[model samples]
Target: MSDSLERDALKEILTASIKEQRAARRWGIFFKVLTFGYLGLVMALMLGWIGAHESESASSGPHVGVVDLSGPIAADGDASSQLVIAGLKAAFEDKNTKAVILRANSPGGSPVQSGMMYDEIKRLKAKHSNTPFYVVVEDVCASGCYYAAVAGEKIFADKASIVGSIGVLMDGFGFTGAMDKLGVERRLITAGANKGFLDPFSPQSEEQKQKATAMLQEVHQQFINVVKEGRGKRLAADNPDLFSGLVWSGESGLKLGLVDALGSVDSVARDVVKVDNIVDFTPQPSYADRLARQLGVAAATTLGAKLEWQLR
Candidate 1:
């Protein structure tokens, strides 16, 4: 009876050990798969395979390289200079590309980001003298969008498309009234007098307002200079509201010299570039990169909600 009991006990221990080893092996396989997936995602992003819009079909002959300029032109916006510049560079570097087209569709955002892209386009133009760059406004290209548009050799749009808002503005909210209604008092401290110049919780300061207006005027002037330099002798010199932060239809824009003509992406590619095939070279963010950026944007927006300051 004792011998039989010992045999049974040893068998049970062996069975439990086997089960534990099997579970360990399963977990090890699961972790390896997870790690491989993560590494593959990283590789795809580094190779510019994911999030990027590639050509639909392969072309043997000359093609018109197109890049999209959609959404706001802010640093954290979809149409940021970093992505646009990368797309433009890729399009320009392609030997089979006869010309480059920037299909702009935006309400404008940041002037600084726009300026950076403008500089890059100009540099690329000089480097590739044979390849011409053009802008085709789809919906709207106002303020900063127009700033970047001017860098192109020609700007086109549909007859109904909105174009041009050549100006700068700084805007904010005054929460003092709201706070007073709610019986809440704000206590903000600063080291420099001008540091809290535009704080919403504080009373409005005439000096700060004037300073802000003057700064906007300076930026507006810079915008005007770029338009003049790019349009060069094309803009209607007699129109007083050309730089007055006013927008116009494509038809009016054509007459005002804001747009060269009424055209679309297809038309430009076919008639101007003389090619039917349009290859979009927009650098799409990888899934992981996009997820990371989205999270960052959410965090920024949440933080910004605490303040009431916005610039245009």
Candidate 2:
């Protein structure tokens, strides 16, 4: 009888344990469903809010596409040729847009990228002859930025703004002395005799200097040609130093015929364009993108801490 009772007790314990496990699994599934459902509801609400906001913004009249040319004019830069071109295209495509503005604030960058943007802007203007294009200089629109400004029908600048840098530049370092101090030898082999003219660690020959200067002069000539084409009769060519890579303030820039008018963003919008509403077409990072970047940084920090602890 005792043996039978022990057997019965064991069976009862096993059954209770199985029942408990099954109940736990069901609760686990319920929690997972609840979490996913909550996430879906939050996403739906966010989307609805975004849609409503966008609808309200669309109600505003006279869409003015504002392209921000605010930094180095390189492929990877904020004022990259690609981004500027995309903004200009958006402006041209917007049916409600009466004018497009290139809002510039830069000391300039790559000549090639600036030239390409200038060409694209001219082409777009030609395609849309009805729409007017203006360049509003913010702070310092020099060199490549000035080249771009000439492409506009009218260039405007703030009274205190700095403008005018019409020149080309190529910069590199000479590391011959540094390498010599470190007892390092440069092993550069080239098929052409003049191919390694600008090698940093190699001694610069007189011939190389002459060759580089000639190359830069050629580029400068190209820059001058583009400015002339864009500015037409507006540029005052009395001063040769205008193209000597020198910058000028807005007031002086007006005397040099570098800019058409002196005004601020509000002035341009209210008086020049005769539109009170301004739309910015500059691409901005989304909230989700910012959140992901923050999360990534946090994760990297955590991993680094754990690794440091392990190393210690």
Candidate 3:
């Protein structure tokens, strides 16, 4: 009886060990699969394969396409013309896009970038005449942001949204006084007569200042012409402050014919486009791209090389 009892005890121990080993193997497999899935997701995000408009497809049915334009627009920024234009192209080319809306919230940026976007919007609008293009402003759409907004068929904004800064300025620091007090002299040699124009450490030149002022005026006139061509008779031409570089509330902008009416993106999509479903077509930069851009900017700053000499 003692032998039989010992044998039974041994058999039970063997069964328990087998069960434990099987469970450990199963758990190991589960953990390995979970880790791989997580890594895949991270890779997809880093490659921009899964982003704002990842779900864009024909099966989505009819929807309003939205392209976001926010922050300071620049060649190396998220709101650059290249990205914005890419979004616009995608939105226009999509068969299910009932309309395209540019959701803007920017204090403006590079005029060149803004102009490229504006021209693309116009081109897209003409190509997709059946699909209406609109601009919905949030926060402030002044300066370069407004420059692009004018290309839209209609401009919508909240009553309190800030709009319009129809002017140009060349702003810089003059460190000559501080340098003089510090007994530091700057020695800059250039082959061109105006090569050292607007040097902060050098003495101010009246001729250079006049030239800068004239250039600003010319750009300002170009901005004014674009606005006039866009707004046409709707603009309140009698308003002296219309192009005076002053920002105004959306309510005041309506009076000046700067904005068509007060509305939001949702309201426009629902009421105007007759589509409640909206898909973002804005191209979000991948993590790798963003990191590269940041590195480039850092290098430029360290080298004291200005990426853009002019800002809108």
Candidate 4:
């Protein structure tokens, strides 16, 4: 009886030990799975693969939609006209969006890109006539940026914000003198006489220079006309330096009628739009898109591509 009882106790102990081991293994697996799941979630969030749709969603009630136009306006840049227009289109389409705000902070870039955005803004504004569109300048809004900003119903800027560079420029380096010094002859053979117009490696011709100047003047006049049409009687018509490719402080810009008033996105949303809920409708480019754009820009730079016309 003693031996049997001893055997029974041993069996009980082994069974209990086995149960404990099984429980521990199960807990270990649960924890391992949880750890892996948490890591994957973090990676997804960091990679911008998740949570983008949530942020891009507009509020159900009345809110001000904001589209940021920062950096140089270029085809390959984040602040490109295509991205800006996409944001604007989304903002206008949203029923909850009471007013649209363009938060601009750009030095300037391509005239064509800027012009395209400007035209789109006008079209959107006309379509959404009830919804007011405004441009709130941050830090600086000059040249191409101003070109687009004028489409807004009103433009606001800080007291110290830089504003206004209404001009067009085409700049390039002449390598003719440098080639002479380096004992390198430019063997450029063009089918047409004006095909090599303003070629950096060749000596600049007076006729080509005149043609280029005339082109620049034409673009500059277009920029000036846009500002006039946008600002209207608010502009100080007597100010000679207004369109002389000069930048001015926001306070001065107000005096010169470049900006309508002094305000920010928050203030404008709250006071002007009568709603403080600012929903950002800026088109967030994916990681792959950004990488591809960078590659393209780098390739262009490597090929020594020059902008034919710029607002800067």
The top-ranked prediction according to lDDT is 4
Reference-based lDDT, residue 212, model 4: 79
Q: Pick the winner on TM-score between candidates 2 and 3.
A: 3
Error of 2 at 243 (Å): 0.7
For candidate 3, lDDT tens digit of each residue in 1-312? Answer: 999999999999999999999999999999999999999999998877776335378679999999999988787889889889998898889999999999999888777888898888888889899999999999989988899999988999999999998877766677888988999989998898988877777888999889878977887888898899888888997889888888899999998999999999999999998999998898888887887877775323211223222223
Give TM per candidate. 0.80, 0.77, 0.82, 0.81
lDDT of 2 by residue, 14-129 (tens): 99999999999999999999999989877755545333222114446786667789876655556767768887887777777778899999888767678889899989999999
State the lDDT at 122 in candidate 4: 89
lDDT of 1: 0.83
Off by over 4 Å in 4: 1-56, 294-305, 308-312
Superior candidate under lDDT, 2 versus 4:
4
Candidate 4, pairs of clashing residues: none
For residue 62, model 3's alpha carbon misses the true position, in angstroms, by 1.3
Q: Rank the candidates by lDDT, best first.
A: 4, 3, 1, 2
Please say which candidate is ahead in lDDT: 2 or 3: 3
Steric clash pairs (candidate 3): none
Best by TM-score: 3
Model 4's TM-score against the true structure? 0.81
Full ranking by TM-score: 3, 4, 1, 2
Runs off by more than 4 Å, candidate 3: 1-44, 47-55, 294-312
Candidate 4 Cα lDDT to native: 0.86
Candidate 2 lDDT score at position 181: 95
Number of colliding residue pairs in each model: 1, 1, 0, 0
Residue 307 error, candidate 2, Å: 42
